[model samples]
Target: MELTINVDETTRNGSLLFKAARTNDTGAMKKLLESSDVDPFIRGNLEETILHTALLNDNKDVMEVIVEMVPSLINEPMTSEMYKGETPLHIAILKQDINMVHYLLQHGADPIHARAIGSCFIPGPYGQCYYGEYVLSFAACLENEEIVTLLLKHGAPLQAQDSLGNTVLHVLVLQPDKEMACFMYDIVTSFVTNKQKHKVQSIENSNGYTPLKLAAAEGDTQMFNYLVQKQKRTYWTMGTISYCVYDLTHIDTWGDHKSVLDIITSSKKMQVRKLVDIRPVKELLHHKWKTFGLKYFMLWMISYIAYTSIFTAVCLYRPLKRMPDNQTDNFTVMIQKTLAESYRTKGDYIRLSGELFTIVGAVVILASEVPYLARIGPRNFFGNASIGGPFPLLMVAFSFSIFIAVIFRLLGMEQESIPLSVALIIGWCNTIYFARGFRMLGQFSIMIQKIIFGDLLQWCCLLFISIIAFSSALYILFQTLDLTNYPYFRDFQMTLYTAVELMMGLIDFPIPYNNVTPSFIYIVYVLYMIFAYLLMLNLLIAMMDDTYWRVAQEREELWKVQIAATILLLEKRIPKFLRHRSGVPGITLGFNDDDKWYFGVEEIIPEEKGKIQAGGIHMAKSVGWEVIRSNLARIANMKEYTESTPF
Candidate 1:
């Protein structure tokens, strides 16, 4: 049964033949192919040929027929002006058609061909084409191991380098799969050994780094250990000691570099020598003593003075008023009663006075301890019990004094107010002193801890102190005014106290002010609170944000170093043809004005090419009033400025 082929002569006009090929009309397609009048490779205006159209549509049958009819078409190089110089094979690879790949390869398709072999593949229809390599690289990235192996086995050139001089091994190393990495390692190793006839020594990538360096930078303990021990025992020995040291510093920058190194070194019992020979142990100890001793001594003296004063005041005054003698007890009682009366009349004054005294006392004490604290590492601030550290103990004593004062205020005991007030004064002193001395201490603590308190704990503590102080003052006020007889006064006092306490509690818990209060007083209070909160929050957020950003930036730098290391390892494994160049490896890809890739050494685009380039301001020349009026009149005549489109 002979099939009669009906020819469409108009198929050759523009994209008619391409459209027919895309549609896979075998009879019409065959008629067009058999007709010598029609150029089998006639491309559309967009440079899309019949084969390209067929490949774009994934029409395997049409492609097969075209290749079979004109075998010469398989060898003809299409200008990138059409399909960017990508052959039918390149299109098939880009389309990820394994069947088409097999067919094209069988029909003399060159897998190793590159549109722009040494430069970044440009995506235009008539520029450089490296679609096949990119497609393969992407496939490897997706962990399609079978397809990768198939492409390699079918003369896909395992050693084929990209514009960046990156081989398949480099791409595989970048894959986020441990299994894939291991598989790639095995395949690459096997290929290298078989091809080179000797075990691979060093494998540097386009970035002048070996695979070992990449693994080290990545903190990939298993891969690093395997490469160092299994592949080349001297791999780690080849680099300068400074380089190794730099690598070690970067370890903490990436994921748990220290931990990874610990695992590997411990397992292998590797003895890591110091990058440089340091001073003798005794010398180091002597130097430390000389440097820190005087500072510690001064701090101790200062701490002693502050501690002694507060301790003396609390002990002496507290016991004196409680003595057995009625004269002393009466005198003390009178003094406390007068102070309470004063506090009731002027609450802000009392609070301010207490705060001032506390701050002054704390400053004197902390100033003394500063020398000692500064000598120690900042992280030691949080460590349990300093061997000779008086700061922690002094802090505890100061806190206790404040606590006692709070109790006395709450009890409304007349004699106790003296000691209570003293304690409150000292507490503020201690807080201010510690804050001033430990300028870097907070940052160091956060860096080491990486905790985000969001000001919750600090605010809570402040709120608690404020509420207690206010409540005690209010209670004393009610008693002084003798408002117990007036029900409204009693109710109002209790209600205001509760509401203020609630506000204080809400503030401490970091609840939004708007959520807690609706009244004008509260609204004003909230506005003030928010202003203060924002001021403090801005400082705190700036500190924490800077710390976080610095850490992240450091980690990124470490990762790049690790990538360089891994590339080095691969370089030693691959052949000379697959290796990267000396200076900036040929594979270093950078962005253009449009964020597209470009070859050659990367340089930052001029500001004019950036998304938001700066331009000189254009100031209009000043016109006289008459001139302006004339211009306005002329413009007004152009169109009526209606209400809908008012000029």
Candidate 2:
């Protein structure tokens, strides 16, 4: 009797075993394997043997038939192109098929297979990284506890290293995904032995980065803590920390000018520091943030003076002496009493608090800035513009007006400025003072500085020179014209102001001269318009456009430096108790930056290192002036600014 098994036409490229497996036909698979003519171990173009094909397709029935028929084929490594030298067991692991892997291992498959059937490699920064999902790494990558345990039970190599020297534990520790890290942690603590685990943990990749080091560099603080704690390493001794802190670019693992610590610490973000549990680093960052809040609060309080003074002067202003029992017909007086008087409205305490707040803010700002005003001039203070600025002047003005009008309770004055209307003269000054605070950021600071100072300064000089040359000729020529009634040509200041207005298009076009003016005066006016509008104005516009793009390109570096300055300024203010404790079991890391801070033995290089004046609110500009904020751009490396520094 003969057994007939009809295989599908898709078996041309694959074996009958794979075709039957795809269809889940156990009968056909069994018949084909039992027949004498068909070889159970025959391979296709990709070197996928019948057993390999069955495993690849997740065909349970075909896989079962092949395993029973050809026991020798189970562990046979292929010689084909795609998965050369990898056996069927490796194929099962790649598929992450727990049941197939269990069946294969039970049916004489080797457990310690390093070459997983379809494992991959990717080009890293240095060279090829073992990025493939192989055996234990495949199970670990999937975060599959059951498959991992099953593999471990069947004696899979726990210390298996990939081509790039990444151990199974290395693969596990580097995964930033929380679930994967948790599973990897569980595998290390439970499955791997202490001796074997330490050996694998110490294995460094070709780039000389260990698993914990890679985790730290990746800024996966959770993974870093778990792996580092297991190694009994602390903040100071961790490879990632030391590599970053020491600026060890000499080492193979130091990938850039920045270390892992630099990348982590230099970040302006608070959340990055909050997520990690690295002993003293978190404390150090906390102090920086605390100082930031304190500085901002102090500045806000100063600005609040201007706000409250103007608010209360208009809303709560009143004559200290009661209104006279006199005028009944004065309707204007009645309206002023009803609307502008504090007692004339809802709540008295709120208005009183507002007035008091303004006075207190004024006093505080004056106390802080008055002594240093001689050294740090008003221009410098306003241009540092962020924390230290001419906000004091506005506060002082508002406070003086309030005191002069109603007379402060502390002062002995009765009636000085009288109506308090004098204080409201510069009420709009508060908006300018407050608005400049937002300009501390590099984006706005650079853009506004370039436009106002760089381009505007140049344009003003050109306009002044042009107006002088053209206005003089006209003024001398029209000396005899009847310009007595018209102030436009009678006085030089008036002529200058009118000329500026004309240049700015505020005056009529086509040169409006007095009817008595000479004909040569009209020629001078035509030449003036041609030069000012046609050439000079367009030149100014082009120059401003150029300045905008140039500053925009540098905004990122400027921002980084600005952020670093603020942190360095405040980080030094942290006392001993605020820093890491010395007596702990781990080594204490001290943070300092070139005598800027005396706190610690370890220091991070500031983003604007050696660029700012060490101990003052002064950034170093041209001529090494301590406080003068100037946009003197040294154009030495302007062309090379965008080029990569090949180290």
Candidate 3:
């Protein structure tokens, strides 16, 4: 009675069960599926499950019977012996059977459960587990999105990375289908919401590439634009300005210290480069003016004198003008008193008049010299020199004139004195405009090749400077021509005037002007006040913004260097035992086969070398490794490898 099943008998029994299921023999398949005497997860010779064989053969009746008999087996882990451990679900997905996938999903098959098939037969590396085979890769391999959606709805993690480090979004970015990518986004959103957890929006692959970066690298402009806009709004709060500050020890979500902005800026792709170059031109202009010119000199002088004169005049004259004369003041005493008051007033007026004359004198000198300096003729009016040579001299003269005017105006001049204050303010304003114009022209000279005929970046910078200069000059001229009388100027002046008057109306004083209407004088005063305030404030703010961005860019570069260093360190520190086994013929060097072996370190090092250590062997080895790794990693990670490989 010691009956034992032989190998032949076992094989025959399994074959009979698989054949019955494949041929839609529901009665036999159900008997086999419900048999307690057999292993429910068993597979036949083709490494196919009875259920998998039924699905492959399109035996819907057998599949339905199996599902009805053992619903738990619908999501059961397949036996390890069949097809090197691939689950029944994996087999159905690989066969491209939408109906089988739907049935399996409906019956509770886990799409996210990965099985480890042999490396020789697996689409990716051995032990590779993707989110689901239903997601297409870059090769346009077909996948069922509807089924994937169903799995995702049932609590599947869309952001779960495969062995190759690609999420559903990552895979969709590689595909050419727009609808697929949008659908993937929706699925990911649902996964996030369902899980009540926030996944990293920009997850990198094994090769350290985010979905956006991949799109950018592939030149998928439409997808790249959409992702950038979406991410920027979501993460950066739609701020028009952004800065990347780098620290050597600061690691990003990808375990590197390099800033995303830096990576984008240095990318060889033109689109990424263009996006990173969108810096604020106004800020740069502020830094340039502050660092390299007479602009600051003029500004300092104007501020110092304007503040001192306005303050001193108000303090000294306010109480005196309001004082009353006593009856004790006799005719001679009254006359003497009157004479003294007139003398004091006349002295104040004379001092202001002198300052006004000095400012006007400087303006006249500058206007006269500009024509001479700008004139290009055989006879050198400014001397035997090119226009370039005398240009600097004119700038110096303009700067000096501004200094002189500012100094005189600060000597306690009254704000209400029409002739002197008007002349002085107008002259200083003109000088500022001329100086700025000349400086800009000089900048144009230096960057002429770039601005007029070179790349778009320089052209843009030039265009920005031109716009600012033109607008500022127009404003100055508008003030000078007494055009506040015109409807447009009146309206323009009113906006700024109204704002200022509302803020400082209580402290304001009346101007002494009989010829010009009070309304016209009021408009002129408001125009100057607003112009000075806005110009100075805006320029300061711009300078600060430029400095911040410059520092940020520098920091970003440093961070990148640190990241590269860390990677190099890791590469070097990789124990020889753990290094990738070389498959190349001959010498068993761990280095990539295509790497050029050079004797000099300078030719191969990943980093810069000192004066004396440029040709060291260690540098050469390190550089060779970096070059080889970068190239090979890209090739090894590409989707083409999976499609082209026999596996």
Candidate 4:
């Protein structure tokens, strides 16, 4: 007779032979665990293996059977079940089951296996995995001597931090009970070796708190003495970072601004351990000093000479004072005599000087850009160029225009005056350019604002369409009415101009009121006011406000790029000798191949064989780029939703 007793437990979720351990049946559990057909170590829906349940029921016979069968299960952390992500050893220690803990440890369990992969519950930075819930951290939290010793002898790391950034020492200092405090002190004295002391004690967790600082904050005097007696080195390696707490006296209890020494010692009056690096600022200053001192001075000398001479020529022109045909004065005679003294004939000296300086300014523009322009195509010139590309060229054109305008007017030749329009444009462009030099008032932000011009252009197109709609209606009305005397609405061009200007309350309606108006015309006027001024105007304002906020979010990165561009442009104007040298005064920090911080932002070194070699994770910025890209995608999806949705 075949004894066919069903040994496997079955449910709707799946079945395992873990039920053999439920009745504390060692022989049945051993047979199931060793059976070729039955997988006794399989975890269930709650991520509970048979070993976890057996440990809860204090079945040492079942626990040993499973450990002897499935050795990998010794280090496998539980996921989402009771005691989430805790290895069997951690749970055994927590329960004070010394034998079970030793059984798992002796089976080659990982001493530093913090948690299972892909089972993180604590949120950290994107593209990074945070391994929280260290077993040592857990055992130290229990503050038992045996548990602590067991994990330490197995070579558990003291540096592994939990979800809240608490180290093993951080957890140890929290136990203030006299008996437990001694146990915690013994744990600290056991493993903290000499070379690792400064590194271990001074390591600041995410909250900028060291173990000593945490103990001080908790007011644990015994733990404080335990740390101080061992921490012989008083001084700390100092640097200015966002989070570092030093001498506790002067600093506030909580902030990224204080140092570790600021948190523990009572003498907060002591100067903080400082590591200041100012090589960048020093180099920038030296570059500016020499650049402005030599090359910039030469450019300005020519520019000022042209500006003053051209200005004086215009100021001395007779047209400015409106000199009459019969008018005669000693002032005119004296001006003529002054010109004669410098020349062989009348107007020769003034003309020559005006042309000379214009040529000087024109040459300055060409000299500054021709070398760069020769190397790259015009498309690249515009693409990689800053705002108002080839701008000095415009200044050159303006100078030459004035020179031409003066000659034409002096010779009594009939021609269009170029100086008036060109001078105004050149002056305004210069004002915009100088704004880059002094961005204190943020007036030059248009340079940065130019990047999101596409978004702004889309908004302009919407406003333009609205304007065209309102103007078209008005054009039809006034054109049909044949209102000849109404200059503001005489044609579609004038009508469109008035339609835009009317929204701002610049143009009053009911024009040509002296004559009688049709009733339909008045009706059209009211509708135009409602649609154009009331509705469309407000809609346009909302779009502009939204655009400004989007632009404002990325302003810092935009400014950084603009600053880099401006530095490049300025560097081109001066020679290498006049620029900064590393050994110059105040330039203490070495400028070597390792230092790639030239663009005003740190360079990113991608992960090389799974190691972050840099001091910081280099940011690829404008936090708003990711934000705006997602928003644009979301908006695009919104359009599809509108198209698909039922009205």
lDDT of 4: 0.51
**Which candidate should be chosen as best, given TM-score against the real structure?**
4
Cα error of candidate 1 at position 24, Å: 2.6
Error of 1 at 197 (Å): 8.6
For model 3, how does the per-residue alpha-carbon lDDT over 302-414 read when each residue is reduced to its tens digit? 65356435433532342124223564434322211222343356666765564455455456556655554443332332222112223334444544644543543344333
| Candidate 2: stretches off by over 4 Å | 1-14, 24-31, 34-36, 77-87, 94-96, 117-132, 173-176, 225-280, 284-647
Q: How accurate is candidate 3 locally (lDDT)?
A: 0.44
State the weakest 10-residue window (summed lDDT) of model 4: 268-277
The digit string of per-residue lDDT tens for model 1 on 1-647 reads: 12223234444343556767879877778887776667776756555567777788988888788788867666444454333455666566666777787777787876566442322243246434332244455445555566566666765554555655555555555455767766655654554443241213233456543455455444455555455333211101112211010111112112232222222221211111120011121122222223332344346447645655654454334322234465664544333333344344454454545455655655654554464445444544443111222334446556556555556645655455555555545444433222212324323332333323333445456655655554454444444443444222254456345535445344242224344322443454455345434544465567667657764544332222222222222333234443322211111111111211111111132233223211111111222334433433322221221112110
Each candidate structure's count of clashing pairs: 37, 1, 0, 12
Clashes of 1: 37
lDDT of 4 by residue, 1-647 (tens): 23343332323112435566556778877666666666555776668777777776788887788778877777766776334676777667668776777777888877686553334433345312232367676566566567678888998888777666766666566544645755675565567764475467656667667776665555455555455434321111113211111121111111222332233222111111110012222233333334443356446545655575575564344232234446656344221222223345456556566546655654565566566555433543333323334454455556566666656656654342456456546644554444444345333344333432434456567668877887887777677665666778888898888877877678688388877767777787787788768876676567667656764664443333344345444444555554432111111112221211121111122334443221122222322334334433332222211111111
Can you write out model 2's per-residue Cα lDDT over 347-433, one digit (the tens) per residue? 555566666666565566466546545444556544443232444455556556765655533342333434355555545445443
Per-residue error (Å), model 4, residue 384: 18
Give candidate 4's TM-score. Answer: 0.41
List per-candidate RMSD values in Å. 26.2, 24.7, 25.8, 19.4
